[model samples]
Target: MPMPKTIGHQIHFAKTLSGLIRRGWWEIPEIMASSCMAAIGIVLGIVGVYNYEKRNGDNKEYKSVYMIMRPDDPRVCLLNNPVYTQYKRF
Candidate 1:
């Protein structure tokens, strides 16, 4: 029991939706490849951050790699370790 104007609008909407879907179908492979590469990059970055360790002294327990460079950064680790304990003063 729909009016003629409503039927016409519905037909127009369906046609445009189908056209957009058809165009998107061709780029599915490229979209999937990009997603996979982004995921791989994220995993590699995580591994690098986790395995990295930089300590001030050679005999000291390992502090975070970022502690020396960004001591004030609360987002990184903050131990009582000195910034340059290993280096000898000239």
Candidate 2:
């Protein structure tokens, strides 16, 4: 006679879980690569930040240029853009 549906389903699920647990399933290369990718990214980021800080050290100064576009500012026509300058000596 066939086993009851409820018991059969429970047994099937348990077998799948047991197989995965016994097989070191997480070590599957695809899974491991994807799983460690985030951690590796974080470590690399930390290393980059540490290197940057070590090189730049304690000077908190940050300089940035904010460009404003004015309707009257003829530069918006973009003939003055660096890209155009590269085509010929300015």
Candidate 3:
């Protein structure tokens, strides 16, 4: 049969656990720092991808001769062209 614990035993156990945590809580900070670094890495990657190909010098529209730079620009030619979005420098 297992020995039953009293209130005093439970209190002592709690006190000991608290003391251990107080003295050796390095893992908590380590986990937090790693997670923060991973998040920073993800944000940086997204920014890099978003800023890629900023200029439209080399970006050419598949069929549209002129990019839709204004509201009056022709859209019939750019309708099926996939490169129309990249053709604009905006």
Candidate 4:
């Protein structure tokens, strides 16, 4: 057995929620678009941090090849090799 006040509160909450949905405040497409935008924002933030560290050469595990500006450069071939090597200053 539920109290009358509790029932009233539940009804009020449901009505409020339904009103919000009816008013297009909680639409499916809007939710999906917002979710996608949030996901993209998160990914962009992660990529920005990665780029920042890459630019600063903070990740010692991955050697930064500064001289190899071109993608087709012979030096870029080193990136494909499985063996990890120490950073060499040219």
TM-score of each: 0.32, 0.33, 0.32, 0.33
Overlapping backbone residue pairs in candidate 1 total 0
**Which residue pairs does candidate 3 place in steric collision?**
none
Residue runs of model 1 more than 4 Å from their true location after superposition: 1-27, 53-90
Best by lDDT: 4
Q: How far is candidate 1 from the true structure (C-alpha RMSD, Å)?
A: 12.4
Q: Write the per-residue lDDT of candidate 2 for residues 1-90, one digit (tens) a residue.
A: 997566432322235766765444434667756757988999999999999877654332232754657778765664244333343353
lDDT of 4 by residue, 1-90 (tens): 986564332322245756756545444668867877999999999999998877654434455663434867755544534466666697
Question: What is candidate 1's lDDT per residue for 4-69, written digit by digit as tens?
Answer: 554332322235876655555554768756877999999998877666644323333454553245
Q: Report clash pairs, candidate 2.
A: none
Off by over 4 Å in 3: 1-27, 53-90
C-alpha RMSD for every candidate: 12.4, 13.8, 11.1, 11.0
Over 4 Å off, model 2: 1-22, 25-29, 57-62, 65-90
Give the whole-model CA lDDT for all candidates, comma-separated. 0.56, 0.58, 0.58, 0.61
Candidate 4 Cα lDDT to native: 0.61
Per-residue lDDT for 1-90 in model 3, tens only?
Answer: 999766542322235876656444443767667877999999998877777645432454454565546646664543444544543466
Weakest lDDT window of 10 consecutive positions for candidate 1? 6-15
